[model samples]
Target chain A: MIEGAVWRKWVFFYIPLAAFVFLLLFPFYWMIITAVRPDAELYRPWNAPNYAPFWTANPTLEHIRYLLEETLFSTWMLNTMIIALVSTLISLVCGVFAGYALARLNFPFAGGLGTGIFVTYLVPQTLLFIPLSDIVRNFRLGDTPWALILTYPTFLIPFCTWLMMGYFKAIPKELEECARIDGASRFKAMLYIILPIAVPGILSAGIFAFTLSWNEFIYALVFLSSPEQKTVPVGVTSELIRGDVFFWGPLMAGALLGSIPVALVYSFFVEHYVAGLTGSVKG
Target chain B: MAQVVIRNLNKKFDEVHAVKDVNLDIRDKEFMVFVGPSGCGKTTTLRMIAGLESVTSGQILIGERVVNDLPPMDRDIAMVFQNYALYPHMSVYDNMAFGLKMRKFDREEIRRRVHEAADILGIRDYLHRKPRQLSGGQRQRVALGRAIVRHPQVFLFDEPLSNLDAKLRVQMRVELKKLHERLGTTAVYVTHDQVEAMTLGDRVVVMRDGVVQQVGEPLELYNRPANLFVAGFLGSPAMNFSRVRVAAANGGLRIENEGLRLAVPPPLAGRVGRYVGRELTFGIRPEDLRIATEADPRDLSFEAVVEVVERLGSETLLDLSVGADTMVAAVEPDAPARVRGRLRLAVNPERMHFFDPATETAV
Candidate 1:
């Protein structure tokens, strides 16, 4: 009886937790189910049972095979990875230095500069897409990943810099002073002391920049005209829609595959991601 | 080890002079302390000597070299800050080895010095543990160890013990004195605590309002303060002061106040004669005022109403008021005294201090 009460206590606490867990897992579960279901079962009414019993039914790999063979899904995935990785690297390099400067150095108009950079982040990408599209068209870089790479950094750099600046500011100035007094040059101090301590924050900001580049749809949709040059979001949406009819199986399959890598990256750096978000918001 | 000399050191923040015309000479292998209240520029003066703050005008010399234009690292001074300033990310070993590594010392040499400092600080076992895992006292030891490993020409302490609890502060104070004795390195310490100044320093310099008030051996400053500020700032329970007028009586000097009058010692008669009939302030320490007994004459006595009696174990502090003036008297804990009762207290004439009111200068 006593053991049951103790078990009940745990169950009481975990019930809502389990419900939230189920709530989060439900959409992914449904997507996997819909992707594997035959076309006959997929069109059934809402009240009908659309899922096959896992033990009795034989699962098929047709959707995965079709996604690979019928469309430029692999090419789109490769292009997205390259664009995201390059953009993240660029943002990290620019953000770290700008963050360090905003956090530590005092220059003429430094406060104004910090506020100006943060305000640039506040301007929505939706508002600037028209003007940026004109610039990309003027440069004749349309239908190329180079356009996305160049345009994405404009959004990534400001927000990433703002995140890293807040993170760097939380570090004690005395630590750097101690390094300086210990015979380190200013550059060496930043490399040895500040950078090591700021790793988590930097990683968090990098993940954010990578995810933003990967998930961006509107700009990718409007800018890239060639099917082969399209990123994951644009390629999936444009190729999956034929004419008022959706190819639910392969589309959902590609979407699920496309989001997995990013989800895994986020899960790996969840602690730092949360810290970065709160840190940037607080600042 | 090297002597640190500050000549006409002045620092200005806008129109406010934080440290003004402050000239200080700290000898090699000597432990000197700067003692003052807040905003008195003791810490500012120390920072200027460390090259952490710029001297608006004047020169700082470590040994024979002018360090006014030098950075802190080139100045060869290690400072133990009040907050310990240990690297939160680094373990104790790394914190101590950081300075040596930055100087491009050999790896083996760095390891030897870090271990030696850790052993001296009794933090060897905890070298791999981060700072947050250590207690306050342990962290303080790590800070001291970091400075000790550098073996710099001068060690500067900016009220290093101020952050510790009272009990740990006393313990650290004794350990610091022992460390100073063992090393015999030139050290400049800053503190607002007079007791810390008296106990730790070979020579104490008291400052006020960005000016050097008095500089001398602790006992010299205690026994013979330079002025009213020094007298009031040095002692606990503080010295009592009352305005009085000096008048000549039978070839001697009589110090008269509203409640009482007493004869000045003959040696001070000449000094008092110049200020005769002029209003002056008389100062006396709490310990110097004793209860009148058969051993002391009644002529130097005054009546005081005892407002409160604090019965500390070894000694008693009596709070007494005479007319509009209040004074504290320290006596044997067993002394017979009751609150709300009148007591006769005798002032030792030879121990009394007289100051010129207008200049606040000793007379």
Candidate 2:
């Protein structure tokens, strides 16, 4: 608590908190306002006397309608959704098994293998997309949803594996041992006992993988071609802007709609996500 | 018929030899306890019996079959960890029923066994609660219920009650003893608390480092400790030791140091005959010493100056300086003792212990 004076509390606590909140939310607020603003008002000069940039007297649904009907925005939505869900499922299944093996099994070079997986996650996507695009071409997966669905796990699996490994390590080893002694085989013990306790860790990993693939740009832009095969991020940018002209209203509308599903996913699992990250086991 | 026999059991963790060659025959339905300090191999031995730790070179016989190569699941045993190891995600009923469920018991039988075990542990009211929702003592009971519901051949407990508070530990200790008596299952319990070992075990095994020092009934080990380490480790305010040279006097042997002279008791005279004129250790318990009265024999009495007085309601402890050595005496609480005062203390001849200083073994 800021002590002694009311003004001190305002200066040290309230003002800084307010500034951070404003800085974080201002872009979303601008997106919402611009999505509803008229084109005439959006294109007006900054020094124009009658310019009212922050608010619109007549809010419109024209941009949303145009985004839905005039372009392949709906197709991109379906494409991104299918790609993100399938890759997240594939990555999660691989990560759960790999993480469990790394955390519990005592094979030789286990520590080195874990470090190698982490190193793969650390490789920048900008450079990795070069070789990955070649693989995509060789597999004859270009201009298709299968291209992004199969390639996204290259990065997502490593990421999910490391996250799940740390979470699995936090659980007590005795839980599995006790289960084994209770007459369950080693595999059954892990499936029934260890995996149930690891629900939060699995959920957090799934959410993170889903968001990463949903918002990915470099690989999605490179491997996928044709307007119909694009995802939200690439589709919004490439289609909304014409040569030397930006469709400010419709572009903001696309941005607003594009972020809603990811936002909803985060808000729904926020409690479990925090618990998973902190790695607290009650017993 | 569940007799656990360990023959030449040993364990080595890379460069560290954790449990040396050990052999034990735990009788059917016996509550056997292993007591020692940290890293003393007590827990390691219990884990070996539980099949959680692989033996280096040994044979373990559960009933009749050798279990050295068997995995824990096939060993027909249940273990309770120090932290309870209760499944946090499961309800108390599910936690108790889990082992039986894994063995593919029918639904009605699983429910009946879980309820029966919960009823025995007095946890029936908590049947639907999750493990995290219960208190520490309740979690401990749930862990016990989990083990008992399985009705395994052997039950292994690794310091199960050490996590509870003092009062709860005592209460749970009594409940555990009662539970053992009712179930009549062979149990191998590991603990560092000597009080728990004495109060719970039908026979106790005392270990140090990685070696088994002594295994006998509680008072038997207390009265006749195999060596100096067992003597000191088994008692509270432990047994006192004073180094003295054995001297020949009056056609018999006497052990004497700077401030005192004491004759070797009749039974131990022959044992001390060869150690005459050589230094040895004299051992006595604090409860064996008392303020000497006129009826006490002069040959068994010595002088000590009181340094501190501690009144513990039931007894008074006097920290005394006897010549160059310090000792503590537990006397009646009403004994009028004060600091800087001199008192004549009489030793019980039969209770005096003599040990060879070099070997630290009983003479």
Candidate 3:
């Protein structure tokens, strides 16, 4: 009787996890099926006799070839890489110093400053876009990748700084003090001691910053006016919807290709990424 | 080896005075331990000397140079924290060599010093392991090795062994004393443990409420505490104090308590003469009280019911009540005593201490 009850408990525990796995993977499976199906089978009725099987023989690579060959997909990918890399780099440099200062330094209004940084992050980017557009126009950087790199840090820095603050706080204060007494200057101690120890957190923050820049859409759509300077989100959107007509095949193909870089980057830093995200979410 | 001189040092945090107008001189190559209860500013004092904490006033001198304004990097000192504070990411070798590298020493010199320190700390074999990979004792040794490699003029240990188990703490206490003797470096260690201070320090500074109560050799502090605080703080089973009054009695000063009275020592009779009718705090160490049998004349005696008798293998501790006041007495483990028994105990009159009732100062 005890064995039967234990087996029932195990079954109850695994059922939801199994169901969630199937739900998560089903969409990806459908997307792949849609991407490879012949054009005639794209929208067949559910009750039709010609509905494709799981292992259909009519699979085609036409959409993938079309996305790669006819459009400026490669250029958009390159532009996205440049903007994300530059933004992530800038955010890390400014955010890490600000985070360390907020965590360790004592000043008249240090706590207020930390709270202010977090408040800045809470101000949605949608609300700042109008004022930011005028600033970008004034700087004469409207149609360049530099515009995105410069604008992204506004959102990225605050959140990154907040995340880094939590990471720094988790570290023992004694470690830094020991380093200081061991002939390390404040900067040297942070670099040699604090920074090395905070690598996982920093990497996690960097991955978040990179992914944010790569996947960002609203700002990129409103900011970039030229095709050559557009990021993946804006470029894909503009190309997929010319006038009122939709191009589902190439759109899905572009999206699949566009998301690959971010997916690869996340996988590379999955450990730090999880840690960093959890730290930020809790904050 | 260098002497540390802290003159009129004061540290204030906003409105609270963390350390107030402290003045102390630690001799060259002395193993000085600052011991106190929590929030007694022992750590604050040590940090101020290490240049990790800034002084609000006065000066600190290492050797002959005033180092009040110097940064920690320029002060030339090393500290071992209570938690060991080993860099979790670095190997033991790198942790030990870090200070040398930071000072821009030659790579060969750094390697040589690290290996030498590691050898002395018995961590030569664990040099490749990170801090988390080593046991608590090994990590503690690595922390000491890190300080040793720096070869600083002074070493500051901020409760370095407080995290160790009881047996390990005793072992490390002996090792630390031997290490100090071998290196002969000026070291300022901070701890709340009186046993650690007594066993390790050449001189112990007993502190309370951000002030130094007494500073003397371990035995001197134990035998002759400067104040009630020092006397109470130094002993393990702390000295018991009871309200007593001095009375004029036939050619000697009579110390009278609620249920006991004894003649004052000859040396203290004249000093305590002025307080003949005044109430004072009488202190007696637990170890000084013993079972009184027919073989000895009881100078000061008390008959009390044993409330609790703890047999600790080597020593037996008895908690007894006399006239509503409870006191603990330590006797031989094999002594024939049991709970609820009426026992006769003798307090040695010469070992008794008297303090001013209001001022709490030793009379």
On lDDT, the leading prediction is: 2
B258-307, model 3: which lDDT tens digit per residue? 76677787888887888999898889999999998876564467777899
List, residue by residue over A92-149, the lDDT tens digit for candidate 2. 9999999999999988998999999999999999999999889899999999999999
RMSD to native for every prediction?
3.7, 1.4, 2.6
Q: Against the true structure, whose TM-score is highest?
A: 2
lDDT of 1 at B19: 90
Clashes within 3 Å, all models in order: 0, 0, 0
B10-39 per-residue lDDT for model 2 (tens digits): 999999988999999999999999999999
DockQ of each: 0.36, 0.88, 0.53
Among these predicted structures, which one has the highest DockQ? 2
Share of native interface contacts recovered by each model = 0.48, 0.92, 0.73
Off by over 4 Å in 2: A1-4
Per-candidate TM-score, chain A: 0.88, 0.97, 0.91
Model 1: per-residue lDDT, tens digit, A139-175? 9999988889888988899988898888888887767
Stretches of model 1 off by over 4 angstroms after superposition: A1-26, A46-60, A272-283
Q: Candidate 1, DockQ to 2 decimals?
A: 0.36
Clashing pairs in 1: none
TM-score of 2: 0.98
